[model samples]
Target: MTERNTDLEARTEAKPLPRVSPATDILEREDGFYVYMDIPGVRREDLKIDINENEMVVTGRAGQAASEKETFLEVQFGPGEYIRAVSLSDLVDREHIKASLKDGVLTIHLPRLEKASPRRIPVQSA
Candidate 1:
């Protein structure tokens, strides 16, 4: 019985934590694109954003605030990690990308590349 309990505890400790994807919204304009994500209970310091090649990844950890001395009578929500990955197109300018988080909402701006932006060509007379 002791060996069985030890094995179970080891397995549980080795298991990876589940990940949840935050709700996101992507919008496109003539000049740029906007991305909004809802990540409740995640602090700014716990969030990470990375861009490599044509992919952008967003990650955040929503940690529980209870201390070691605190005891819960009824447990509901627990700690969780949030992750989201976005694919970038050739038209987007990766150098000028920007992001901001406010009130649990993360907003990312991806501007269109200068060469890919629509422009009116002037007509030439012979």
Candidate 2:
């Protein structure tokens, strides 16, 4: 009988991770904008955000969090990557943008530029 190469067999059996888009919501306020995204199974260390040329990119790697000792019989959500991009407007102040992740929820704050904010002009009676 011929011996088989287990390393090569494992490599061929490996499947590529899936790519998914997380549910997102954007809310505009008088002072700025708030973005909320639902990205479950993603860890803080595996998340990345980048801003360039009026575009904001968000990416995260999500996978099963169970320990190796725990074996899954039926799998619904497998390993995957979450990606989303937003086109920023000129009114946004990119320098002051902030983001946070809590309980599988990502929140982003995009503050508007001072000059771009609305102001009330005083009415003078002539």
Candidate 3:
């Protein structure tokens, strides 16, 4: 049954959101995690970020040439979309996620939630 549930989850994630798999780096620290993605030619205005539960979806569109119906000497433009998705673990604090984009690179910071511990009680020695 657990295997079936895992399969179902995989299928659900594969249903939508065509992923481009942009170059990315993930840095893990004691308190949090940082994600850096390189999306060249992508503009800041066309970037999108969506977070749901443990899933984070990012999509960005690169800028296009101003001229229309113009022939390019070299066809170097690939798909304009830059898409990536990440599944976070339970420790991540979803509400405190922060993101920024600069120089065609996007960075996201995910803070981890503090673990609960048993309260210490003081006792007087008889």
Give the winner by TM-score: 2
* Winner of 1 and 2 under TM-score: 2
Q: Per-candidate TM vs. native?
A: 0.76, 0.79, 0.68
Question: Which ranges in model 2 have alpha carbons more than 4 Å from their true place?
Answer: 1-13, 69-71, 120-126
Query: Model 1 segments beyond 4 Å from truth?
Result: 1-15, 67-76, 122-126
- The lDDT values for all models are 0.83, 0.82, 0.75
Looking at model 3, report the run of 10 residues with the lowest lDDT sum.
Answer: 70-79
Instruction: Give lDDT tens digits, candidate 1, residues 7-94.
Output: 4444335654448898999999766999999988899999999999999999998875656444455555556689999999999998
User: How many angstroms is residue 96 displaced in model 1 relative to the true structure, after the best TM-score fit?
Assistant: 0.8
- Which is better, 1 or 3, measured by TM-score? 1
- Supply candidate 2's per-residue lDDT for 8: 27
Ranking by lDDT: 1, 2, 3
Residue 125, model 2: Cα distance from true site in angstroms: 10
Instruction: State the local distance difference test value for candidate 3.
Output: 0.75
Residue 103 of model 1, lDDT score: 96
Candidate 1 displacement at residue 80 in angstroms:
1.0
lDDT of 3 by residue, 1-126 (tens): 556444444433555433467999999876699999998777788899998877999989765543543434444344357888999988788888999998888999998876622357899899
